[model samples]
Target: TVKPPVETVEVSPPETPLIPPEKERAPSEKVTPPLEVEERKEVEKQKEEEIEVEVSREEKEEEGKGELKRRPEEALERKAPERRFSIKTIFSPLTTITESIRKRKRRTTALEEVGPPLVKPKRVPRTLKEELPPADWRVLKEYEVRGGVAMIRIYLDPETSNYIYWVIEPPLSDVEKDNLKRLKDLLQVSLPYSLEAVEEERREKFLLEHLDKVMEDYRIKMSENSLEKVRYYIVRDFLGFNKIDPIMHDPHVEDISCDGPGIPIYLYHRDYGSIKTNVAFPTDEELDGFVVSLAQKCRKTISVANPILDATLPNGSRLNATYGREVTTRGSSFTIRKFREEPLTVVDLVENNTMSADMAAHFWLAVQYGESMIFAGGTASGKTSTMNAISIFIPPSSKIISIEDTREVNLPHENWIAGITRGGAEAERPGDIGMYDLLRAALRQRPEYVIVGEVRGKETMTMFQAMATGHTTYSTMHADSVKSIVYRLENPPIGIPRVLIQALNLVAIHKQLKVKEKRVRRITELVEIIDIEPTTLEIVTNQVFRWNPRTDTFVYGGHSNLYEKIMDMEDLSRDEVLEERDRRAEIISWMVKNGVRKFWDVARVVGEYYEDPHRTLSIIEKNPEVEGNPLEVFERAAEKGRKEHLKAKSVAA
Candidate 1:
């Protein structure tokens, strides 16, 4: 607050005028009368004496030594003394200068008495609330993703008794929307041209640094927390799948589908199955642009001329899209099949009850002994997952090659080659590198094991040829039974000869069925191909394992040719082979119990077992309930083996 400026009153004689003369004269030109000058001198002397006394008294009062208790009447009487002289007599230059100096001093003293001015606190900018699910819906689960920038809510709709997948993100305020548009515009021009070439791990950091530069240059102002909220959106849209980014981040989500514009996107939850989400593009242009962006992200192109795009995303998710309304009536559509970064292991399968420990052990033995197998199942029946899980059983030292139209198989083996097919530029297929080409080339590499993502075309024949040539192969197919697998194999597109089918020694049929009112995937049957009947030419088979729907358990057929083969190849007694199988089964059970299910962790343990079985078994027997990092012992063993291998190579050189 400012104190009022001090105002001083000058008392003049009653006969003298209070205002200056209209015709003012300069000091040099004016001459004062003798009587007036003498009177001014006397008046100035009296005023100086009174001023010094009043100033001394005021200073004493300020120091709290005493109070100036002069009455109002006495103050008036003191001023009355000044009225004895005429204004012209007392208004000498010296007297006027003294009065002006006194007034300025009073004003300065008043200002010094005031305190610091008040300051109002800054107002925090408000943010929009996150949108919520319907009031009537009950939330089954709610979890944070994208570092709490987004949330996933699984709610049950009372009206339809269906679960809804709801994605909640901070709603953009009008100011934020404008700022985002500006930022995108600025970033387009300022960002480095080689952004796409950045490594996946460094891309986020790079973009964040670039964004900071751009925003700073443009003079954007925001709180640190507000800046982070904006950064989340920028990263989500620029580096991730815009509308479905939250769902994509969710580990439990396996698939995401967009039927068309104005339709809610759907996602497949591992526990809740298929559910409709709350995010969608409301306009055809928006969806078409998104689809085009997806194609570009996959390093492919889609347009009205060639509307359909089937490719693998950078993160190894399978993307199938159709552009425009030419092929699909509902504007544009897409389906993404997201695979886990760390593929499931056989131990994970056993833990999830997708297959029993016995079945996993059987696969472990078969895969170890170079037995070719095929996983047959309907769509979304966990065919590829099961195939991948069992693939971890392949001996770690084996040279493996995998070819696919879209990348899905992920392995922890070092001696592995991953190949993806490339499409031709034209419809005539002049330069198309199909899966068959990759598979054929892989065989030339002399891989000890071959993995085909799926057998839907002529590649099936090459796969069977590889199996016959003793290159233990694994693949998946869109068939639910051994007969259906045979039918597809012997049909036009695949067209494998009946004699060549015998090369496949094992087939695992997977099916999706409801058990205990919940949808689940199970290996319905594990069958083996024995031989072709001489007279009827029917493919003879042995049922090694079958799932019992009533009890949700697997029943062993009591006999396995795999065991007989093991006995002959290893030259061990039948009891000895059985005991080994049982021991392997026990090891699988221990892994499941101790939660050693990560792909690389399982691979380390398996490799250690191959390098030294007795040591592995003894470790497990001693520490049945291993505390932390269940594969610690196995990892140390693997590390030692690596050092030895490197040393031997160096010595040889």
Candidate 2:
């Protein structure tokens, strides 16, 4: 009554239902479709067959003969399951079925549009030929320095006929140079002003960190190769000797001489004589700055007010520099006699043909007997080197004192005192400690041996007095002959009495001259100071060994005053003393043959011989090279002896 009996209307069903009613049927039962559905299924089945046939024909064409072909039965089997699944799909929602059809079409279209995948070929790397060294120069040798960051190429210029020490470092690109400029500016502001206290190794680490920070802050994009190149330049300029850093690292270089600005730097190579280098200060300003820095490294100050600087660098190399044009005409000048880390030994002298083994053995005997001697030579004549080398011959137990203006004397003796002269701030040298003071203090200390680096001033008198007082004093002087040494000692600056000159036992005159077009250092004359002739009041000297220039060999004089002294001291005959000298010579020869040239290694050998002569000789009888480090055997023997002595002492206690 309310809605006209609900309008009793019936709704008819459509041709397809979303969810079809399931009829109970056996598992093997098959369902047949209506006419139009059967026709549609047949149309789909024909399309699928056509697609399969097309795929099979393409595959057969690709595989060619003897390849397996797809069978129709297998294709039918695979499609049968797909056809069965389609029936269930028919009852699916219209939206879902339409979405699936769209997806299939999209996949087909995408595949057709994309076609075959494109593969990019690898890029071929370019082979860059290294730039050839200058055509005018012939390369004598090329060796790496600075941990392989730089190379040293020694070239011979045929036109000029001069050897050039060329330093080859990594070439920086324009971008890298710009980055370096910015980074250096940033580092200069960030780093502390005084890095003198910082260790060399730590300074490099700090520099690397600062470089990284600068790059990050400015967002500098640089490749690792470029970064490394930039770092090398920074370290070389900041921590090292700038353009001359590579030359400094070369072990073969003995001296670096910078005459003036704009002049090619000259190097004294151990084998190649004095040679010009590719490195130079192109401007006076740069050379002045370098000279100032060198003075600072020596803990000294140099300015136009104080033009001359004579100081020792931290590495023990002697430095003599002039600050400005006020003194040096060209500009600033500097001379650096580089110090050798591994000091030359007696064995080294023999190996380098600087001296004969016989002379070294004679020095060995003289050093043992505490004979006072002086090495006289000009500048850079290797007088100091000879003294240092022969000093190893001093008995291991002797109390020795070495006094020098610079720290040049290095010894292996445990009971040794090394004294260096201290310069004063004022011109008068108010708080100065000179060699004279050091010599006096050394006398009070009661040293058996006194080594004076050089005798050029009042200290020569004190040294002679020390010699007279039975202190075996050795020194070096600027003299080429015995008479010159006497004259220099007895002159105004160093006025030693004629009698006092007799206290000196030996005088070694060293000279540097060319032999076979190569520079060589030779002990021109080994003269022994016998005594002062009463009639003429002149010093007497006996030539023990003389260098024959024509033969390039040392000639032995028939007799040596040193041998006579040794015989008198040991109460031995002349023949016996000569035999002992020969034995020592043989030992030095053995060391040279076995390449035992290190300072400590030679010291160990000499010390062992001093402790027990027969044992050292017996050990040498065997092939030391075959047995490995001769030091190990000596050390073990020494250790065993020490243990035995300690045990005996304990028992006694």
Clash number for every model?
0, 0
Predicted structure 2: lDDT: 0.76
lDDT of 2 at 425: 17
Alpha-carbon error at 344 in model 2, in Å? 0.7
Model 1 over residues 1-653: C-alpha lDDT tens digits?
A: 11112222222222332225895455444333323334445556654433311211222423433223343322211222333222221223555534543443211000011122243332223211124555888999999998788888899999999888888887776667756755665566557675698988999899999998866654567767667778988898899998888988899999999998878788899899999887877778889989999999999999999998989888889999999999999889999999787788888888878899889889999999989999999999988998888888788878999988888888888999998888831223777888888888898999998989888877778888889989999999899899988898888877888999999999999999999878888999999999999899999999999999988999999888999998888999988987887888988999999998888878878777887787678767877887777788656645665677789989999
Q: Write the per-residue lDDT of candidate 2 for residues 1-653, one digit (tens) a residue.
A: 11111122121222332124584344343332232233445546555321221112111343332222335433211233223223212223555444544443211100011122244432223211124546877999999999998998888988878787887889987777766765665566546555666777687887788677656754567788998899999988777887788888899999999988777789899888888877778777788889998898888999988999889987888888998899888889998889998999988888877899999999998888888999989888889999999999999889999998878999999999998888731224678888888888899999999999987788788888888889998898899888888887778877888888888898899999899988888998999999888999977778999999999899899999888777788899999998999889988988888778899999998998998787677667664453576567656766666677689989999
In model 1, where do residues sit more than 4 Å from their true spots?
1-132, 424-428, 633-653
Off by over 4 Å in 2: 1-133, 424-427, 624-630, 633-653
Clashes of 1: 0
Q: Indicate the residue-level lDDT of 582 in model 1.
A: 80
Return the lDDT, model 1, position 498: 98
The TM-score between candidate 1 and the true structure equals: 0.77
Identify the candidate with maximal TM-score.
Answer: 1
